[model samples]
Target chain A: MTILATEALTKRYPRVTALDQLTVSVGAGVTGLVGANGAGKSTLIKILLGLVPASEGSARVLGLDPATQGQEIRRSVGYMPEHDCLPPDQSATEFVVHMARMSGLPRTTARERAADTLRHVGLQEERYRPIGGYSTGMKQRVKLAQALVHDPKVIFLDEPTNGLDPQGRDEMLRLVHRIGTEFGISVLVCSHLLGELERVCDHVIVIEGGRLLRSSAIGELTQASQVITVEVEEGLEKLAARLTETGETVAVEGRTLALQVRADETYDLLRDAVVDLDLNLVRLEQRHARIEDVFR
Target chain B: MSQPTGVIHDIGYRHYDGPRLGRGAGAVALWVYSLRGTFGLGRTFKSKIMPFLLFGAMMLPTVVSIAIMALLKQEPMSYTDYAVFMQPIIAIFLAAQSPVLVAPDLRHKVIPLYLSRPVTIVDYIGAKLAAMIAALLILLVVPLTVQFVGEMLIDLPMPLHTHEYLAALGGSVLNAVLLASIGLALASFTPRRGLGVASVIAFYMFTLAASAVLTGVLESEGHRDAASWSILLNPFFLVNAVQANLFGTQPTEGLPFPSGAGPALILLAVVALALTGLYARYRKALAA
Candidate 1:
């Protein structure tokens, strides 16, 4: 089911159009909103959250119109903003509990939920420390914790792994995956990194220059192409010659050959050629189309 | 099926299926939070210094008055004059604390976090203004209440009238609302706390000084009516004039305006303008 839908939505600022007649539908599961900086990712999220009004067209979030029912939409949808929005003087416990109370949880329930959410986000002892003293990864977890403490139907995470080391990014991605799958919360995780989203996002929407570039399921977008890469330890030249003689297109790299898998029997043909040539097959794998290729 | 190798631990991340109290509850929560923030309740010790100091300063005069009444056997001050006596301290308190109520949220860009909640811009602005007014009311009323109770306990010279005391209390509340609205309206203009504090102080100091000088000059030139009108420019004198009129007390010296309905009307107009400006400021800030 479509959770968020924007129809020809446009946002025009004085000097630039932030979102220009963009139209797209986002469904459940972990969806990645991929765009370069200034590609209108933040603007689109703001429009969906009703933080900024669109200049033209219409948008609906969770079946509520943003123009009139923005408060209702926000009540059901949680948003983790892209910028540094946490107050430095407040500890994660204080801030998240306050946010939970703001979401209408009773005082005791708010505290309990905040503690649970903080623990779930991997912030335990540090939750008591002021956010000013937190590392970037810790601060990001606090941000995520506040968003989850409210327990909304969906969350719009803008650049969830923006500033993180490789390990931190991987950990954050794992958490995002768990939030969507284990917690059963739909997530619209925004990021400029195409490869990072490829792991956690079930669907990917690519926008460029404030317009829709592509929106498809991750499986469809990254489906295996008709190209197979074969690496041989020895007889590389012989393998290349054998593949060409069989009327197959082949591109020779340093130590491997990229051949087209024209038919299901193409694998058997290549295997037979390798065996007949007495070539040692080091590797044979089909190349999958990456989400980045759609942008290119 | 193979038995599970790992234990299923309860992580305690339960979904909230309870009552969602919607916008009204959120506004009340924000109001309470902002009120606590005004006194630095949930903040560090460094953040609590200014508020406590100013509050102590506000209480100092009443304490001194009570001491003089007990030790020297004299009536040094009255409830009617409490606001004027506490004017500078109150101004400092408002100047210092208004930014505490507003600037941090904007400076941290947490306004978006707030806006993304179920509350509207009006609800957010209203809650903040209400919080500031409540804080200022406490600052305005507590010292006066202490003086009233002290005089009753010591049997001071002045005759105690419940009606007059109630009027003074009401006027003090009005005074708090006026000052808080004006201070918060100005503080809401910028995200920088330093700028917010500087602008609020500058506003109060410049207007009070300019009006005092202007009223003095106009009165010296025998322009009594013009002088009375000029005092309205300074919120301190205007509130004093209205309070004197409300409490049935003589207008304090340097108050160009006489105790009458005209000054009261002028004070009400200024409050209306301040409130309107406050509303407009938050409306614009939250529009994005």
Candidate 2:
């Protein structure tokens, strides 16, 4: 079921329009909002959260109109901002408990929920330490815990893995997956990276320049990434010779090679091909589905 | 190697199915949290220093005055005079603590988190305003209450002292509103606590110094009317003028307050403007 939707949503600043006639519907599962920075991802989140008024459009969260029933909309929806929003002085537990109270939980329940949510987010006794001493990953955990402390129905996480290293990003994505699956809470996670979301998101909406580029199921997006593209600084001919010798069709375009995955072994063969040829690999990405691929 | 058959128990991730309190509870929670922050309660030991130091300084004069009065069997300082004389300490308290109440949220970009919840702009600002005004009221009223109790213990005339104490309390309310609004308005503009602190203190000191010099010069030049008008420049004197006119207490400026509700109305207007400024500030922050 659709938990939130925006129709013809547009937000304009004095100098530029942040969101422009963007219409999208999100259901009760993990939905990825994939867009680059300055591509109206934050603006759309704020609009859905009812923090800012859209210039010309209608929006709803949890079936409540954001313009009129903004309070009711926010009551069920949580938001974790992309930026560094945590205060340095308070401990994570204290901050999350305070946030729980802000969400209208009774004091005792707030405390109880704060402890549970912290543990759920993999925080331990370090939650009692001041947030100023926290690593980036710990701070992100605190942000997530606060959002989940009151048990919101849907949580909007803006770039939840913004500063996380690769392993941490994987863990965060797994947590997001569990939130939508195991915990049965809906999630709309925003990120600029396309590859990291394919594994966790059930649905994906791609936006660019404040406009919807594509909205599709995870299967469709992943299907489009089956064709791997690789770019190398030199020795492209030698690499292509090695790949073609391995019985895979290689298309050449300006020193970059595009190959379709005939089997799961194709990726290993491709990596070996480059290493065997001693090619200076400038780029090696399987998920580099271009804008043309998206439109297609 | 044989796989060990270890079963893992369920750890967590329970749904919160309890009753959620409504807006009133949320507002009260925010207000109390903010009030605690004003005095650095539940915060770092370093954060506690300025507020407590100022509070201790605020109480020192009243304690010494009460001790001396009790022994001498005479009145030491009037409640209104105590408020007027401790204006610097009160100003410092506002300068130091008002930023503690509001600026950190801005600097840390915490406004979005609050607005993203059920808390509206009005609810958030109202809580903050109430918390700060309450803190200011407490700072001004506690000394008045302490001295009032002290005077009663010394066997001062019950009727006269009670009446005077009530008037001071009334004046203290006005001062709290005026000072809190101005201080919070200044604090809300920039997230830089240093700037908020400096600007608030500078604003108070400059106005006090300027008012004193201008009034002194005007009175020396025999411009009694101009001198009386200049008293409104300093917020403490503005409230004192209102108190003098309303309660007929001794004017702290040592000048006859121009009669009527003019001073009171002007004080009210300044308060309204500052509050409006603070509201506008948070509205912008929320939108951002």
RMSD of each: 3.9, 5.5
TM-score of each: 0.91, 0.88
Model 1 off-target regions past 4 Å?
A: A233-246, A252-256, A264-280, B1-9, B70-73, B156-158, B161-163, B258-262, B276-284
Error of 2 at A38 (Å): 2.2
How high is each candidate's interface RMSD, in Å? 1.1, 0.8
Local accuracy of candidate 1 as per-residue lDDT tens digits, B161-221: 4555676687788788888889998998888999999999999899888888988899899
The best candidate by TM-score is 1
Docking band of candidate 2? medium
Question: Candidate 1: deviation at residue A38, Å?
Answer: 2.8
- lDDT digits (tens) for residues A1-296 of candidate 2: 98888899999999989888999999988999988789999989887877778899898888888878888778787889899999998899999999999998999999999989998898988999989999999999999998899999999999999999998998899999999999999999998887777878999999989999889888766565667778998888888888898899888877788888899899899888878788788887675453335645
Error of 1 at B114 (Å): 0.8
Lowest-lDDT window of 10 residues in candidate 1 chain A? A44-53
Could you tell me how far off, in angstroms, the CA of residue A230 lies in candidate 1 after the best superposition?
2.1
Which residue pairs show collisions in model 2? none
